[model samples]
Target: MHAWESIQASVDYIEEHLNEDLQIETLANVASLSPFYFQRLFNRLVNKTVFDYIKMRKLSKTSEILKSGNSRIVDIAMEYGFSSHSNFTRAFKETFGLTPEQYRTEPVVLNHFVKPDLILNYVMVNENVPLVTDGMVLEIFRRRLEQPRVFAGIEGEIPIEQLMGGETTGVAAGAKLWENFHKIKPRIPNLLPDGNELGALYLGNAKEGNCIYMAGAEIIPGTTAPGYQTFEMPACEYLVCGFEAENISQLYGDAVFKADKFMNRWLKQHQIRTAAFGVEMYYPPSQDAAYLEHWSIPEVDS
Candidate 1:
């Protein structure tokens, strides 16, 4: 059978026996292979191990039943193949950080828990920058932005001890940043050139002015630029700068000199690292998105 056929067969077997004593050996046998070979093939074809796929699928289905608030936790657990109520509860808590009961009580949350966009919430925080934590607001930005060139290194999903922060620096010390911009591809791209990005996630309210913007905010967020080489950009009007600054890094008051020149306030929230390489257009806002313009900062997606 083809790989897809094998995968479908294995998945069927798993869904039917979730509560039973499950293991790699059992599924490998079901897939008609040795455990080592089975595990490797599963990972290569499914982008997940057999163990993870089964667990996630079960938990997702259980979450749906729980949201209905009609079934008892034990019943829901059993239906999904958990060995015991305690075991089911433990797994649910670990996966969601909240108990089944607690999650179901929130009507909207329970309804949306299984939804991909709803479930995969991104947590962004820029701890190094000095700013107040209380008044920050994280907003969802959906807009198209003009793509620009930038310089920076890239980081990969690996151990830092292995190399220079894992993979190549998307932006090297002096490597023209835009050269490697495509390396850090956008998490998602917009459809039309004028289409908005998946979202322009806000870290928080703009502080006095320490906003850091990079150009590669969305890696090709707009409609394909075709020959021009499209780059990601959220199509939306930014709450342009109401804060002013000279140097981009020093937007925050780190040194005594910067402190003296610092704007009155800077919204010190977490930075969304997923946006494209963007430039911060700083200025004190007179009304809405308009501003006097201080310094430009490039941005990227979180």
Candidate 2:
């Protein structure tokens, strides 16, 4: 947490001078760090370089102003640090995959964070199906991911039972615990690689609407997250499994089943095992009820 104070200060400085032509050196000075180290650490902790993060945040908020239909794009762009209308338009297109006018035509890009904003209910809901003989049902083509640098995104390394709550109590607690994401100091977009829409999956006991919300994104080691929270996922092999269906819930059940199967196999081979907790990173919720992103539970040999 040494850099926590400095990072917050930098953010404050940026907000106050959002319209100014602040350079990287100026921002590094805000945090009292040398330019080179500040750039590296800031990217590692927050998942975006200082300039990019500031620009994106400004643009996201600017989009809000544009939606008001009161101010002109040129004025908004200048106010938010864009040098010209073309510059703002180009950046906006890259970030949102649409031009400003096109954006206004579509639905608002959801700005939900995976924090404590999720409301909860406590009621029992059962959606379990029998496990297969092998326990793992789907086959995943494993892909090597660049180890992402995540700041203190998670307090504790979560396990299978932790990632997916156990019974009724587990569901209730998980939902409430993950709701704090929506209450961000300054939420930034970490869009899903597939859809580029930034958000999280909210799972809960539907009978009572108790939900567990997992927010955050996969970033290269250079990128940074808000709150001085940073993470560097150690390099490891991952097994990815996906399920296609009309319902999102079944998709998870199948993916989890695969993970269970893999875990059992690993345990049999090693007698005991240690590894990073692996969780599903789902596609945009808008894709369909059938989308899922199931990651192999990250594990390290003991």
Candidate 3:
């Protein structure tokens, strides 16, 4: 097995045994490497020591349970292998800058250490080959829009840190924007009935540490929706990454995060230059599946 696969095996083991005591020697055996080598490889791939990764993951999970369940803090800590309440609180405060009691009373956006999707780092594909892993399918191809497309919806600005922090980082501003758009969508006129929605991110002000997020649907040109803002996506060639999930909720955060990482790596490997903005096309969800397509415009050569 490759080094990455070995590391991934150990990671999977760590996840499965998070509630149990994890020894370096046992993890090294899982990775089929010496203890010292396993530690080095894990740190290099995960950017965290094995101990730190396991602790953070446990804390992350416990935080969710705290928010949604009525479990006692001490019991939750013990369930996650924290030897004592004080140790758990100290670790939680060190990581999130809040005591477990404080966080449980009023939760906040947390920069969670999400599990690394290692396959995304190694997968490569083109139009002919689609990568499938963990019950999700990912494809990439090129598309061209023959004419400008107009989208009308609600717009909002989110801090770059919160945006990059994914779904666990407090209330999802983008999701709220989409919800607001849908609430007002019936009042808007001349929207295409194709059931496709667009969440476009404009990064022009990213240097200033903010992003503009627009959640809306495609509209016919010359169509006017009062009280709504319109963004015209110019005609251009785009590199599109398409993926499907078991449900719409699964498409956000984890799936999109992996797809974005893979897409960015693929672009860099192919020496492609992309525009400052990107669009996420959300198809109508169904009982069985949901689909999302991420579109990145490529810069035209002079």
Candidate 4:
């Protein structure tokens, strides 16, 4: 197997055996590498030590379980191989800045560490032939818009660090903005019910390292909504990268992050110039539907 596949295999093994004792020797064996080499490769690829990755993944899983059901904290901790409740509490606080009990009492959106799908970084296939691996399907294609598309929604500025960090303390700024947009969407007129939601992220301040994020649905031209911001995408050909996940929950962190990375790499490899902003188009979940489409407008040479 290739290096990426080997690492991915070890990662999959870690996920399956998260509730059990995961030993370095065993994981290395899964990757068919020596423990020392495995450790180095894992750290280089994942940016985390093996031990840290496992601990963080366990804590992240514990957080999900804490929110989903009424289970004792100690039980959850023990299940994930924590030696005791105090140890678990200490680690949870250090990682998430909250005790398990506190998080369960008033659950705020915690940016849980998602399992990495490294294959997205390596695969680049034609649009006509999508790449499928481990329940993920990725497609890249070019699309043209005959006319400008307008969106009506609310806009918010998000820190570039938080947006790219892949983890957040509470409800993500973009998510909160989307919630607000949905709440006011009913009042917006001339919205196409069948249209997909669009989230556009543009550079807001280079020195400040912030980006402006807008969330809304497409609206008919000339449609006006009070107290709403309108964004327009000019008629142009776009390089679209899309992916589908078997588990809808993966759509948020794991899938979107990987897809964005893939799209950026693909553009760079092709020497493609794109507009300043990036667009994320969200579609309703269905067997036939792609949960998200990452759109980039190729710059037209003047």
Candidate 5:
């Protein structure tokens, strides 16, 4: 089976047996991979280690049970494998930003634990028309990048919660920075012609909520543009995912989010090494649709 197919099988198994103890060795065997390789691959693709994913899922289910107002908190916690009521409360608060009592009172919607669907290794895009996956034209490529590109734009270190929600102040800050960059675009020297409005992502730890993203463009060598910060990227092989959308403005951020998720899974399944960084490329509009690209570093073999 393909890497994605195998990995997906493991995911299905986990979902089916959420309450049971899941061993890494068992999951790795399901994926037909070694314990070490499978563990690393699962972490990279899912953005959470296997244990974390299982724990989060348990908490997520518990939250729902809490909303029902039926089961006692202690019993619910024990059912989900938490040893004590205090342990469950601590984890629940950390994951959902609310204590069990607070959550039970308000029952606010937490971030959805989206089950990833299979991301096709290849996709086709046609200009002007809405994208249809008929295997028409595949616009993907793998390029070896030997040098890093310098970027100048707005930078924001946002809490992951705010970043993912799109309605948070963190996202607003990024929007403001992008807007400021545009106002001074003409004055920025050495800007690349037809440059991609890249949203470069720097994620340190999957479990941590802190993430840094840059909204910027490639600049010429040794060029200094005032009022903008510079980020120097290291060179590596890249997998370029291409698509054409009707509204490029709305697509830019959405594309980056989806691409990052897909790439995280893709990179591990293929045993491709990549830095935790990704670039979002926004190109000029075409007659048919706005063209966009997501660039991901494919780790070089040692």
Candidate 6:
């Protein structure tokens, strides 16, 4: 198997055995690599040591369980491989800034630890033969816009860090917005050609809980509707990365996270700093395979 596929398998194994003791030698065997080389490759790709990743993942899962109100804190701790209640609480508090008890009572978004997705489909094709792996072509392009694009739909705000959490308060807000949008879509009127759904995250130096999240559909100029908002997308040069998905409906949660992660790494590798704001555009299959485009502006150095 290829390196990316090996890493992908390692991640799958880790997920399946989060509650069990995951040994380095065993994990390396799963990836068919030596322990030393596996550690290096895992660190290079995952940005965390094997032990650290497992611990963080456990804590993350415990956080969710705490919110679920289904089990005792001690039970959860033991179930996830923690030695004792005190140890679990200490690690949970350190990772999430709240004890398990405290989190259960007053749950808030902590530094949501998202499992990193293996970007197997992502290929930087400046190399030989221009190959396509995993039924998707990943490309980043810098485009200067000549005119502002207008979107008429709904807007909402979500906590920045909460973007990674499971069914979070912020995610609920977005879900409600989309729910509302779909209910009123037929009445909204003058949607632009092509079924492209537009979304934007405008951070603008905002704190973790103060990010702006907007979801809308591109519309022809001068279209307006009652109780619907309009966003005049400012003209700017944008770094856009797109992936053509073979199955669009399945491209939620992990798939979306992986694509965004790949785009971030690609930008960092090229030293292309991005603006606080970004947009996601979804296109329907008739145009091509259903695809998602992630858009951002290059950060200006002061």
- Please report the TM-score between candidate 6 and the true structure: 0.62
Q: Candidate 3: deviation at residue 2, Å?
A: 0.7
Better of 4 and 6 by lDDT: 4
lDDT of 1 by residue, 34-149 (tens): 88988887766555677777777678677767776598889888877788999988888776567777777753221111111100112332322333211222222233335442
Cα lDDT for residue 143, model 2? 63
With a 3 Å backbone cut-off (N, CA, C), the pairs that clash in candidate 6 are: none
Candidate 6 ranges with C-alpha deviation above 4 Å: 1-9, 12-25, 32-135, 163-173, 193-195, 204-208, 286-289, 299-302
Scored against the true structure, residue 174 in model 3 reaches a CA lDDT of 66
TM-score of the candidate numbered 1? 0.37
Best by lDDT: 4
Ranking by TM-score: 4, 3, 6, 5, 2, 1
Off by over 4 Å in 1: 1-5, 12-26, 29-32, 108-198, 201-302
Give the worst 10-residue stretch by lDDT in candidate 5. Answer: 129-138
Compared with the true structure, what per-residue lDDT tens digits does model 3 show for residues 14-81?
Answer: 88888898999999999999999999999998878999898888988888898889999999999999
What does the lDDT read for residue 26 in candidate 3? 99
Clashing pairs in 3: none
- Stretches off by above 4 angstroms in model 4 are 165-171, 205-207, 287-290
Q: What would you estimate as the lDDT of candidate 5?
A: 0.66
RMSD, one per candidate, in order: 20.3, 20.6, 3.1, 2.2, 10.6, 6.5
The alpha-carbon deviation from the true structure for residue 32 of candidate 6, after best TM-score superposition, in angstroms, is: 4.3
Please give each candidate's TM-score: 0.37, 0.38, 0.85, 0.91, 0.49, 0.62
In model 4, how large is the Cα lDDT of residue 162? Answer: 63
lDDT of 6 at 294: 87
How many clashing residue pairs, candidate 2?
Answer: 33
Kindly give the stretch of ten consecutive residues in candidate 1 with the minimal lDDT sum: 111-120
Candidate 5: tens digits of C-alpha lDDT, residues 228-255: 8777766666777666555554344434
Q: Per-residue error at 130 for model 3, in Å?
A: 0.4
lDDT of 6 by residue, 26-139 (tens): 999999999999999988877778898889888877776788777988999999999999999898877766678887887664444456556533455431222344455566
